[model samples]
Target chain A: EAGVVQSPRYKIIEKKQPVAFWCNPISGHNTLYWYRQNLGQGPELLIRYENEEAVDDSQLPKDRFSAERLKGVDSTLKIQPAELGDSAVYLCASKGNTEAFFGQGTRLTVV
Target chain B: DQQVKQNSPSLSVQEGRISILNCDYTNSMFDYFLWYKKYPAEGPTFLISISSIKDKNEDGRFTVFLNKSAKHLSLHIVPSQPGDSAVYFCAAGKSSGDKLTFGTGTRLAVRP
Candidate 1:
């Protein structure tokens, strides 16, 4: 009955550096999602995966952002040449398509 | 392009009083609505949810009221406490299993 888990709860990187965040969804949950939360803003969906298939990623910045959930249970989100504007919290969530549970999130600060 | 909106950037409520937070959505296709509460350095936690079919749903001290016709929904916290101070986000889910669209959060400050 563990909740969704994410790694590197906090990260600080320089502008134009590459950064990656990881997530492990709850056991038996088929739906996984990654979201970005800027200061004073709600979490925005970057990508959503249903058992290794990316069902939605329209919000992801394809030019520098890429995600994968090939194994389905765990997923990774990466941003290349990160910009200062990318400084925000990356939250990982899992659901049964019924209820969502979020992880502690990886807070990235790009200077 | 922001479909879900929480116009109130923040709210200050005295403890032990009712704390009401409001949200509005433009998309009529959104059938499921949810509320999430988050503290600093943490992810959002589900507070309550309501379906389009129901006008209200209640759990303990938290209640969610939906007005589909007006495209408005609200969360009422009775006897608010200091612990209730956090950012609350309202999200809408489409009927076709599409991803949720969330509003800019509203920060609630309950003064003791």
Candidate 2:
């Protein structure tokens, strides 16, 4: 089976521009997550979905960040008017609660 | 405040020696713990996991040990190799909470 897939492995945007990333989770996996990893730090969960509903989004910044898992198979995370502080790797992962399989991630650089 | 902590930022071990990584959590409600390994430019991959009731779980040369009373856990790699060098992360979660709290991570460098 194919692992989780993410598009646009790398992205560069202006400080005020908007950017979006896409994720396709492994087939049959029930849980999906979006994470942000800064340099020298472990991933921080930004949002989590169980099927089409977002079960956890407390860590997501509502002002500039939004995520949707339409129909539950694929997901999209968007950041509007990005800031320099947003430069980091955005990762998508899928699993069945305990163990997760991750995508390579999209490296976002806001200049 | 950081709920999960990995005090050691990095570790170096001989290729044939054992490598031990440690983690501590502030939440006693965490009923599950996991370890993940990540390489540069790649996302983390699940290494192993242990449930709260169990103190130890072993898979091949990798072993995870939990000390629930102390809210601490550890991962041990026996007969370590150069290929095993990577960043190790410890995560904790409750059965009811869908989100996981991750540690800062410890970089393990296994040298030949």
Candidate 3:
């Protein structure tokens, strides 16, 4: 079975520009998560989805960050008017019975 | 506040020796813990996990020890190999399927 898949392994955009990242969870996995990892730090949860519903998203920056999981399979995370501090690796993961598998992640560089 | 923390930013061990990475969590509600290994430009891969009910869980070369009372956990790799060099992250959650809180990773360098 294929693991979680994320598009755009790397992305570079100027500050104040809009950028989007995409993810496709593993088959039959009902739980999906989006995390951002800054340099020298661990991945922080941005949002989580259980089936098509976003069950947890308190950590998400509502002002500029938005995420959606359609049909509970694929997800998209968007950042509008990006800032230099937004540069980081965006990781997507899906949970099985116990373990959560991660994708290669999309590295975003805001210049 | 960071719930999970790995104090050691990096560690070096000679090949064929043992490598121990430590982690501590502030959340008492976290009942399950896991360790993940990552390489450059790659996502973390699940290494091993242990439940609150058990104090120790051992795989072939990796072992995870959980101390529920102290809220501390550790990962031990025996006879470390050069290929084992990578960043290791410790994570905790309410349960195995719950959302995880991760600690700043510890980069381990196994010198052969």
Best by DockQ: 3
* lDDT of each residue in A39-81, candidate 2, tens digit only: 8888999999999999989999999999999998999999998
Q: What is the TM-score of each candidate against the true structure?
A: 0.97, 0.98, 0.98
lDDT of 1 by residue, A1-111 (tens): 788999999999999999999999999989899999888788899998889999899999999999998777899999999999999999999998576889999999999
User: RMSD, model 1, all Cα superposed?
Assistant: 1.1
Best by lDDT: 3
Model 1 alpha-carbon drift over 4 Å, by segment = none
Model 3 alpha-carbon miss at residue B14, Å = 0.5
Model 2: per-residue Cα lDDT at residue A69? 95
Q: Which docking class does model 1 fall in?
A: medium
Q: Which pairs of residues collide in model 3?
A: none
lDDT of each: 0.92, 0.93, 0.95
Candidate 2: list runs displaced more than 4 Å: none
Q: What is the lDDT ranking, best to worst? A: 3, 2, 1
The per-candidate count of clashes, in order, stands at: 0, 0, 0
- The Cα error of candidate 3 at residue B85, in Å, is 0.2
Which runs of model 3 end up more than 4 angstroms from their true locations?
A: none
